[model samples]
Target: MVNFKGIGEIIKILNMNYSKKNYAIDVSGRGKATPPPLQHLLDPINKIVHSQRCATVTLPCILKAPLPKNYKVRWSKVEPAEYMEVVILITNGAHHKTYGPLGSRVRLRHSHRYDASLTISNVALEDEGRYRCQLINGLEDESLTLVLELDGVVFPYQTNYGRYKFNYFEAKQACQRQDSRLATYGQLYKAWTEGLDWCNAGWVMEGTVHYPIINSREPCGGRLLLPGVRSYGAKNKSKDRFDAFCFSSAVKGRVYFIRGHLNFKEAIQACQKDRATIAKVGQLYAAWKFSKLDHCDGGWLEDGSVRYPIITPRTGCGGLPDPGVRSFGFPSKLRKKYGVYCFSVK
Candidate 1:
């Protein structure tokens, strides 16, 4: 459990106003900076912090100095390739301020006077990325970078355009539309270890197409290769076409079926009538995995595709013996009628 004795200290720190005119500190300039073990702080050997969704995660920043004053600790989310960053918080010993979405959920751990660590609550998928914690004290400014990874589930995704129809960019956009992101090789491997068996190759984060196989089959890879993730190697992001393995974490909302014989437009209206919205593909997957949502009847998802989650497989339910989401591909928007899955963010 996190120590909350410093609540008054946190309120006191964040309440103090330290405007730019009074506390103008440049964190970008690292001229001739010595490699860490910074003189003021020390970081962990492995800077990767892993946690689950909706959990609190701490990015450690141990201070070596004795409650140093006139020094500000700045935390920012570093973008890929270091091209951009969004500030999360900044505190100059007394004054503190927060910024951006992450900032709204972040606070200084402040377990002790010497602890300058940052804690983020209600962690979400968007918070998975690189973050930098910097200590600015005149020319002695130094920083440390940490990567936040969430343990989650991975599923293969494809659009109505059919298999092998999406390029890298389009595949990513499709995953985002479904409330997920392109799964990295590590995430895919983790899913494979937990019994993810698929025959079709899909796009991973490294711009490669691969598929996880648990059973050796004649149709998939000729049964010659052992049961593992078969790879197609790296391909052109713009030219190569394939399905995608999307990664998603836990859901904070409820996904339920709104029984109705409705088209795509009607499905949308049905969800809106319930004061909710159509459930995204990823949200449905999360609900099935985390909440054990099981339904035999096919329902319209947000992407105009009909699907159903079956936790206890039986006869006549998609006619298969797998406990997973059964998809019917993308059907006609105006002609098809099905029950709609609505997501209520409560």
Candidate 2:
């Protein structure tokens, strides 16, 4: 919900359910200005976020009239719906307080100038979500919405079924099985720009099959072909069989490689013994890309594949010149033995 005020201190009455279902509220006062409609204000907010790469996002929530000294700015987050019960009151400008699992520096200014804005510093992957910024006007409840996105790495995947075994839908399901989603074209291109190289063609989020060849060769594309992301365009969702390119977003928890080679089932038990769970493919990729996790041996990911991240490739470690998350495809879970990666929040 949004509140609109006309020029010269006009008051528009808003009647919405102002349920304080456990959230924090902050107050700000911005002096008189020719304010635009709530709808007009939202478009600019989206442009500001999407236009550039940002570590921190600044969002402004508008209020009618000179902000009341008692008027407040409120913030809350909800996800999975089942965890809705954990909504918390983070802060109220002056009387700052902490809430939720991941904590960042949230600041608010009630200056007598521009509209009230909230800033969260040192943003993390878990910070990506829908945040409600509401204005406290007694019965006339007004609010605005703020959305955050993550910046992370993407890796291509192949199920135990091997290359070209998946159609578009099966490719998507394969990524989900590995605790990942099908990579968007944008995500794949970003990975290409960040030095991701693979020879096998795979399915991405755009209902298309593609592959990146950093160094063209006879097996990859062609010996004379230049390096680039090759595309198979849009293929039939069910008929086409191909591998999958999966995307992993940054996560809040930590990932560790469990000592000793363990198969799929044993991997889960190993992590549980250490107060953790088997690390997903995404978690491992995030740890590799962001946390600089470098492992030489191919270990068991949550999807039961043997893989390793070689940030600095060398002999016997996948590629020699290229840095990537190398895969042994999806190996036999019960027959093959490999170390397992685990993840834990605490």
Candidate 3:
């Protein structure tokens, strides 16, 4: 049943190739960088690394060849939509230089002689994307691509215009305005696993519209249908309209509730008295998901809407069986009275 002899022979051949400097290994296993010739290559099947927000992650990139004395190892992030590459850092074994916002949080992990990996500290949601590690040696260059995925919570977003008013482009802009991005299918699935149930369909990534159904009532879909994420397939990006499912990661600041009977203007003043600003929708969701923030009183958010986080669902709190950030919609700026949620940026 075992083929140890064949496996050993293959390893031996690979080692011989490495010794001869005729091969190379890109972490993605998609093959070696061309033109300048490869020395020793080892391609791993799976290279994607999943990490949570604010957690440290190391993107592996080992070059097995006998590197030149003056070669440089550079790391850059590739934007998913535009394929725009931003250099994070560059090093030549001893001296290193960092660049851009990401550069301040990233450094090369030179643990071993062959290691040319990158270590990112305090990872943020904008850090999710493709990263490229390139080995440059004069006329020869070998590079590998690694994907960084963040584990976070997803929330349905809609404008004041009401439900299903945002087209694909508008939905993307709305999420961005809320300090979030359109959630990916995998991110939505993860949210569903953590008990996300919404009736309205929303735009996810890739021009796809999807919704999660936990209770499965008639208005949502049907009582008989099984509980899962429902999809409307790919829709017209310009014509079809839907809400947006935005994904937000852990926040550095803390969101707290300051109980008071205040309107929109007074609510802002209340937070200012406490030396903090009104919390945004994305910050509230991040606090609820990561810190388990629970409050019963409706609080005025920065967007003029009233909402509250409910980690433990109860009868008096919106009377809903699910645990989520309950919303009271956009209340009157002058008449409706509520508390305020303040965010302190430390």
Candidate 4:
């Protein structure tokens, strides 16, 4: 029979052999020399390194790993199965594989066993969603999920700017919502003269209009008018033609009408309240096309010191002289009381 010390020596040798072999062995207390305790030996070995033995994968875009390498990474829309290609670059040398809705393109770089990297570019809104990486080694495999988000670009006029017609105030609100403003005079002029009006009508910036502050004058006002022209008329015959204003820029020119319907006295008061003055002949001419004046009523001409009516040979009514034929202040009764519309440039 084996002695106590002899049996102990045999067990120690068996234990040492098991350690070097990287295997589990069991021993029994009986003289029969039973197989080493398989389960007991394996418990500690499994606990120490089972998880670490498997290959680990990482995505620069992902926080965890065991992702696949050297495989086609497919990217698709979350809601729809449409395939998309996203550009991805791997930073680490570890072999990895990408799969399922990976976007447009996949680029891989070799990395260390534990190190990895990934990147995507030219991302689109639909490209946003979940992405996954799968990794495989001879004996073990792992996988991880990553989320991709793509930002969208929004252009102006996509909102109500195209659908509705907004006055100055309403237009301003619309622009603000779209992160833009109404077109400016410069913009409007550019659009019109440069033929960009074919593009759209509301180019002016918010709170901007050809007719803000009611009565205002244009700079280089008189220069825009046609030579030998004294007056202008409206398009509608039955309706009294209001004074028209013209604005010219290096890019283009536009004509706008002052809101009409006020008598001469009322017009003067309106201009005063708005800090403006009555429209002048040259300004009116600049806005009115003589070819288009068939229905418009001519405007009043004022040279600062005097006012004259454009109506030729003003018919005498109840002994009142014709104001049209006479020079400044000829029609005494029509002097200051003459009804007229005005504009301001400020």
**Model 2 vs. true fold: TM:** 0.61
Candidate 3 clash total? Answer: 7
Model 1 CA lDDT for position 234: 91
lDDT of each residue in 1-346, candidate 1, tens digit only: 1122343432222222233213322222322223434567777787889986788999898888564568888887755322356678998866689987777899999887778899999998878877778888765576676779897889999888788889999989999999988998888998999889999899987688899999989989877779999989999999989999999888889999988789999999999999999999999988988889999888999888999999999998988766889998898988566899999996
Which lDDT values do the candidates have, in the order given?
0.81, 0.64, 0.81, 0.31
lDDT of 4 by residue, 192-254 (tens): 343221212232331222322111223312445422212221122223212111221110122
State residue 213's C-alpha deviation in candidate 1, in Å: 1.7
Residue 299 CA displacement from its true place in model 1, Å: 0.8
Q: How many backbone clashes does candidate 1 have?
A: 0
Candidate 3 residue pairs that clash: 23-39, 23-40, 23-41, 24-40, 24-41, 25-41, 25-42
- TM-scores, all candidates, are 0.78, 0.61, 0.79, 0.20
Question: Per-residue alpha-carbon lDDT of model 2 for 6-79, expressed as tens digits?
Answer: 32111211112324222332211112222323421232345223211125566555444544565555565533
Worst 10 residues of 2 by lDDT: 7-16
Off by over 4 Å in 2: 1-149
Poorly placed runs, candidate 1 (over 4 Å): 1-39, 42-48, 52-56, 65-70, 80-87, 97-101, 136-144, 319-321, 334-337
Better of 3 and 4 by TM-score: 3
Q: How many residue pairs clash in each candidate?
A: 0, 2, 7, 55
Least accurate stretch of 10 residues (summed lDDT) in model 4? Answer: 45-54
How high is the lDDT of residue 85 in model 4? 21
**Rank order by TM-score, top first?**
3, 1, 2, 4
